[model samples]
Target: MADIAQTRAAPLRHSTAGALAGLSLAMLVSSLGTSIANVALPTLSAAFAASFPAVQWVVLAYLLAITALIVSVGRLGDVVGRRLLLIAGLTLFSAASFAAALAPSLAMLIAARAVQGLGAAVMMALTIALVGETVPKQRTGSAMGLLGTMSAIGTALGPSLGGVLIAALGWRSIFLINAALGAVALLAAWRFLPGDKGSGIDRAEAKGAARFDMLGTLLLAATLAAYALAMTMGRGHFGGLNMALLGGAIVGAALFVVAEAKVASPLVKLALLLRDPVLAPSLAMNALVSTVMMATLVVGPFFLSRALGLGDAATGAVMSIGPVVSAFCGIIAGRVVDRLGAAAMIMAGLVLMVAGCVALAVLPGVFGVVGYVAAIILLTPGYQLFQAANNTAVMADVDSSERGVVSGMLSLSRNLGLVTGTAVMGAVFAFAVGTKDVATAAPVAVAGGMVFTFAAATGLVALAVAIAVAGRRGRIA
Candidate 1:
């Protein structure tokens, strides 16, 4: 890992409460924008007369682009400058959002959304990285905790708010709202963020002009792109084609790994990933958590709306209840992590996640006041624990020089995991539908979901217990 440095640090000053508040708001704006759009997909589909399959692409495209690019751009921020990218990202996001609002066709909306995703990538990559640069290290966890809370709130509020917005205005109003929020975030970044000469930026431009391995990046990009396209095309109609594409993507990913292994300053530095014990565990955690989180996403809507017979508003409210609690609980979890260490915090989280999933998996048709809902609330705290604790461990383990790559790898793991989790849940649902006890199909699907998530959580718990029992002082985390 190459260290990028600024010759001088900005003058030390504790940012005002107002500035911190502004930063949290920026996070909320971005979180709300994405969450709101996802929840409103049904309305958009009806408005555009889109096939269910095609409408999926609209949501998937944004997720794919954001997942693929966030890590790369985040590393670029460390190489160049966080502030420059922060402002540029907001500007591009706002412009794209405005354009999306006016898109007259589905094709246009998809393209515009991909661009919006690119901007979001930049923002996600830099947001926490920028906070590290701006705030003193001591208060960093608290700041990040609040950001997580906002994200949870946005996610919880998304469906209900999106439904209201679409009912009152139109589907386009979601993008319109994104435009306004982006503007505010832009202003906050410009006015409150500290200034410094972007590290490694001018250096890259000088002398012989060193190049980051664009080829390696492009190869990996194609791997993800092809895979996402295959996923979008999945089903009996294109099952054969999906298989072919999946095969090609697997080969591309293999080649990418080979190329990264050969290069000194590889696009991702796969060597670091292999050599560091800390990094290895972190990556595993990332992949597992993503798989669990997205599996719930796949199953939650069906359980709430179809099985529970809840309307969109009620579905949103009930489904989001866990997230609402998780949001505030993240702060407390972070503090617990500080006191007890990552190992303890992580173990507790994984255990809760399993317990939560078990409840839902075995849930009866009727809610016993807190039976179904309590499971969701239980699931929420664990999510907070996973995000707040593992992230801290990752940061603490890796050197600042390699932070960009670390962030990128984590981001990639998360996105790919979402796709994989969704696939697993889809498979489980399809299988359950074929059973004789078909009326209880949803619960069976829920049980299958718990099986996958618990497996993931179980793996993490095993690792956490090992660390706790052995007292392994790892280098990478």
Candidate 2:
């Protein structure tokens, strides 16, 4: 009788765990689609006879729409109901994927991709918010670990899977595959995932959110768009207007930040990050690391294929090693952090990333895929370690009421950093190469980008080290 009672009680303890797992699966599907499309871009470009600027929009459209919408959509879920948003997002994403798969022109494809981005924003919002709510405070680290592992796998598999599909069918197959997975996720979420009606929504969740900040959204969107365009257009050497737009982006972003700080129920809690104990270091470190990692991901594929003279299949295969290793190592990083504390893990991970970037930057141009693959494997472990630990640290410091906002801010930092990193690094590499043949120009481009990454990694590690040294004790997972 006692044993049976304990067994039954176990479910009560982990009721939210199952929901988290379902949410994790949803993240994997969406993230995989993002990267998988990258590997297929060259093939799509060839087939469409698309210009370089136009081909790039396939990615930019998704990034722009997703980044702009994440905070608004996520906070809305907290205000309304997470489950409602989840269902709506899945439906819209599925429809968009179908259209993307059948897109007859680049313009139509960009539109479809934007719709897909909107859906992705919802999924991103829900996944972390669900973990924060469902998992007990003590077990949140492990829950986040599990979520991070799945997302890492999706990131790694996307390129390789896309390569196979593109080779077997055509570029259309990549988008179609996403549609199929979205369908699967929709079914799974509907069946296995519990309703968020009485879950993930608390008294403090986005109270008084009816007054959405329209002007703030517009200014921020314009800034983000203009900035992204500046970076992308600068690749071929910028016109005067592009530079002017870049300057405007700087001004717009400043205005939005100031506006957000003063508004009642601001669109983003820019002030909270300043006032909160947990968020300052955690968010800063996460944002810095994210910028480096995202830039690496964007440029690494192009470098692997072009610099080392590898093909799509081989490049994807090599890229898979990092995420595959991350899946395994992430577990260990989580456990180590739980026992030894996050500061150590943060330092170690940052060190590894610096080393990895330096190696890739300095590696001989002729080392081929082996050296490239090895460097990425080193990079992934650091990324996963930081991701899990950072989330744990941030959530540990804040009250439960603040988790939704914190998660949204954390995710926004990551997405915006990634979008910026990729665009900037990619354009830098493109400029370095100067339209020379990939074989001749790629080495220089890769070196320049990796140098930037190495510098960024060093700067991030310096911040983590400083924080570690400055404090006596902090909330640890």
CA lDDT of every candidate: 0.68, 0.70
For candidate 2, write residues 1-477 as lDDT tens digits. 999988864422334645666687778876886777777678768878987667877877876776777777776666656666776788788889899999998889889999998888788767787676566676766776777887787888887788788889888888888788888777666655555544333443445455656677677777877776775565545689788988999999899999887777676777666756567777666767777776566667777766666687777667667678887777677776677666676667777776776666655343656666667777778777778777777667654444555676777777766655655555555555565343456566655655555555556556665664444255442
Report how far residue 285 has shifted in candidate 2, in Å: 1.7
Model 1 lDDT on a 0 to 1 scale: 0.68
Residues 138-239, model 1: lDDT tens digits = 655566666677767776766668778888998899899888888988877777777645456464455222466677877877888778666656642347
* Clashing residue pair totals per candidate (backbone < 3 A): 2, 0
lDDT of 2: 0.70
